[model samples]
Target: MIGGSGHVGARAARALRRLHPDLPIAIAGRDARRAAAVAAEVGGPTTATTADVGRGDLGLERGASFSAVVTLVKDEASNAVKRAQADGVPHIAFSDFVSEIGPLVAHHVARPTRAPILLLGHTLGGAATLAALHLAQDLRSVDAIAIGCVVDADDRGGPASQADFERNEQIGQAALVLQDGRWTWARGDAATRRFADAEGVEQVGHALPLMDVVSLAAATDALSIRVDMAARDASTRGAGHATDLVVEVSGRLDDGTAARLRYDIVDADSYARLSAYGAAIATERLLGLEGGPPVGPGLYHPESLIDPARAVARLEELGARVRRTRS
Candidate 1:
């Protein structure tokens, strides 16, 4: 994995080791010491490599080969993706996935790879969305999905994650949401809306743009998709020492009914940890495919390639309490 020596990437590397003990894993980063440290943590003879994206060979030996490379590097995603395409290697990106990457995805489709490129922009999206998908496993006709995540303002993520978050803020944080059967741009992730959290305690959420709006809609064929993220309320701030986040996904069924899912997790180390788990899960699933990779040479989100049930089941195993309700 590229950029696999940081807080998130390292954790992901460790997770990968736990899941695939025999798998040869490598951790790449600018700091060779740090990469070596993370490799040591994995307790395997993992390779510690430098990652200088610009210095040709992407900071690795030429003619290097792998089943797939999972990129946790943010902002530099396009470059890494380009490198993967050039090497004809399958790539899975965990961050820096935005709508603007459309062109890169299209390019991959035209050029093709030995295996499909998976962009997990909506990695595990929201608890509700996953739970809803598990409930709708029959592939029922659904028209809308209300998915949002609650994050604590004080709960800052890793450096790369913070940078990615800041970039979205630079864009005015307006999200394209499905409203009344049409696309409407909404402003900001701080517009508060009242909702009960996982514990049935009232909480607030602000609409925020995450990749769920794009990938979820496309993957599920949902005509409408709404996304938001909640920042922690001061009331619960100083009271707890654990990191926490609330994720919800609600869907409009064909019968005009609504189904919602919720998960309140306390003790999330960082978004990086969750992302690492997600990457590991996807990797495990991909490696487990009977004949070959699920989809052929093209860019796709996890929802499109992974079975929802399998995906969420793994998430729970990794530490997420998912609950579902329909009305």
Candidate 2:
């Protein structure tokens, strides 16, 4: 684990430990003392190491090796990914914005890695996309998909998450949406969307450049796909500490009937925990800890590798509730 000293990273480490008890884990960050503290908290065969993504080898020993490298911090230099590719270790990073990932994608395309490199920058690290797929399983042909993530105003995540949030604001990146089978960048009024929350209350969301649009479009061939994010106070739902993901899909059924479906994945904990759960699930899939074949080399999205049914089950096990809201 890289950047494994922050709040979300600590949760992710615990989640991974819960799922794989005997697995050897490493908590790496620039602050060795902080990383060691988190590693001690997780217990078991975990260790703490210093990392410098500015280095090609990630500041590790010349011949160090690992089963996988999960990154929680942003690698603007792409050095972590480059090291992973060079080492042929499966890798997944959670802190990538749509605009910043293009060069990394291009680099992988130019020289594909021998180990699976997953791009999982979606809401909750691709959990929202997985839930959306599970909800659309009954559909025969998907025409459109709109994903909304409502975060509680009081639920400011860890330092890394807050930093990422600020970066998104400063970047002022236009939302990436699929429209009429063509990918488009939406801005201004076009980026604003109104949707129903889990409680059926109207909520205003602004389009965000999340990886969900690209993954959903590729997985379902949806002509219209976008993900919007909104922030609401706890009082809005008469509940403190709740984050919800609303997935709405419109398409044709197996009977050739037009239909629309919606589901809500509500987590009583903070979005940071939900996101950590997602990262843990992705790590398991990448390493084949769930009694399946490990993912092979090449680039991939979480939807391609994760089983929606299994993912939903895991989410429920992690204390997240999924409910059908509309039919």
Candidate 3:
């Protein structure tokens, strides 16, 4: 893993160990000490690699091979992904908070790969996509969809993530929501939305066209789709930050009936821990360790590639509560 030293990386390494006991793992990062620390925590025959993913070449030794490389870093992923493609290694990137995966995804679209390179994120894109897809199996004509999510205020997503959100929010009057088969700029422009979290607290949310706006739109071919997210209220996060994610999908049924599916997600672990679990589960799926052949080489987000049911199961296995309601 490229970012095995970070919080998410360490947690993910531990999860990966639980999932794959015999799989040799190397915690790779720029700092040997940090990498070694995480490797020791993960136990097993794990080793440390003083690899600088920012360098793109990953500072690998000649002839070194790996089953997969899961990165917790984003800023360097653009180059690192290119390098992984060159190295003929499968890659699974943790969510890019900076939203820089567009160009990378675009490039892959232009020149598809035979090696699966997945962009699996927990927020914005990945979570909502999974929720929508899971409900999509029984729905027909997904004409419209709206999802509202809430994270712990403490999770503010860090400075880089905030900067990115502000930058994107400023570029348009509101987030880029899909409406009437076209992109529209608005924030919660559809309706008043409320989310009943695991704590039995009802919270209001705003519409923000996060990455899921695009990925979900494409995945469901829905003409109208939007995602709204906010930090869980301060009162809830005062003690510690646990993520409270909610999603809703709506459309017409094959029998011409209206249908909607609402989802709730609660994870006791911190956001990074939840993300670590997600990344590890996705990595296992991609590696085909749990069975089934790989999806073959291609640039894909977790939603486009992974089976939604399986994905949900993995998240719950990692101590997350994911429930859905359909009507």
Candidate 4:
């Protein structure tokens, strides 16, 4: 793991340890002390290493090997990606945005590797998209999809996540969405939507150009697709106020009648934990630990590599509650 010291990365390490007890783990980050602490907490053949993501070799000694490279940080320079490619190991990146993924895609196209590269930058590490796709399977046609994620106000993420938020604000990049089968850069009111949250409270969500919009569009013929997020105070809401992912899909049924479906994935714990579960699950899929074939070379979305039903089951096992709000 590249950012194994951060909150999400550390949680991913723990989740991986729980899922695969004997897997050798390397907690790598710029902060050697913090990495060591995390590794010690994870226990069982885990090592902490100082890694410089900016370096070509990831600042590791020559001949170092790993089964896969999972990064929870934003790799703006794509250094980690290139290194993974050179080593021919599966790579899973969690913090890249759709606007900044062009160079990485281009690099892979120029020289594809035998190991798979999974882009899991969706809301909560592709959790929302995977659930939405699974729910849409019961419909005959999918015309529109809207995903909303609620983050607790007090749940400020790690340094890397906060930095990414600050960087996006500084850059002022418009949110990406698909409308009427056309890609659009939404802004202001156009980028905002009002919907009921998991607690049935009215909330306004703002678009952020997450990877879910693109992935959903490719998977189904959804004429309109967008993902928005809202942050609120969880303390005031009593219990069941942790982060939640709301997915709504609308289209026609097999009988040609109008239909809509909505589901809520409520996590009683922090969003970081839910996201970590997603990363750990993806790591297992890449390594073929679930008795399935390992992912082959080429870039892919989480929807392509993961089975939504199985992912939902795994999330529930990890303390996420999935409830159908509409049908």
84: Cα error in model 1, Å: 1.7
C-alpha lDDT values of all predictions: 0.62, 0.85, 0.70, 0.86
Q: Clash pairs of candidate 4? A: none
lDDT of 1 by residue, 1-327 (tens): 777887668877887787667878888877899888888888766888777655556777666666666777662536677676776666776665455567556667677754567766553323334444555553346655665455556656668777877887887766667665676677644344576555456656666655666666556666767765556654574443133445444555456566554445443454556667777776665565322354456666666556767766776676655454444
* Global fold similarity of model 4 (TM-score): 0.96
Worst 10-residue lDDT window for candidate 2 reads 233-242
**CA RMSD, predictions in order:** 3.4, 1.8, 3.4, 1.3
* Arranged by TM-score, best first: 4, 2, 3, 1
Give the clashing pairs for model 1: 128-249, 208-228
Candidate 1 lDDT score at position 20 = 69
Per-residue accuracy of model 3 over 1-327 as CA lDDT, tens digit each: 887777678888898898788878889888899899889989997999888766756787767778777776664447667766666667776645324567667656765764678876446326567867888777877877777666776775544345556766666536567888988766544534566655557777676545677777777878887666666655655243377666677787789899887777776655667667767767777777763665578877777667788777777776777777876
> How many clashes (backbone atoms < 3 Å, residues ≥3 apart in a chain or on different chains) does model 1 have?
2
TM-score of decoy 1: 0.83
1-327: candidate 2 lDDT, tens digit per residue: 998887678888999898888989999988899999999999999999999776777888777788898988887788888777777888896888777788668767877856688998888888889988987898999999999988888777877778887898788758898989888888888899999888878889999888898888878868999999888877768473388888899999999998888878887777888889999999999999873788888888988899988998998887788887556
In candidate 4, what are the lDDT values of residues 1-327, reduced to their tens digit?
A: 999888888888998898889999999998899999999999988999988887767888788888888988987778888877888889987988888788778867977865588998888887889899988998899999999988888787887888987777777858899999999999999999998888888888999878999999999999999999888877655487688889999998899998889989887777888889889889988899963788888899998889988888888887788897556
- Looking at candidate 3, the ten consecutive residues that score lowest on lDDT are 232-241
Comparing candidate 1 with candidate 3, which one achieves the higher lDDT?
3
Lowest-sum lDDT 10-residue window in model 1: 123-132
The residue-level lDDT of candidate 4 at 213 comes to 94
The order by descending lDDT is 4, 2, 3, 1
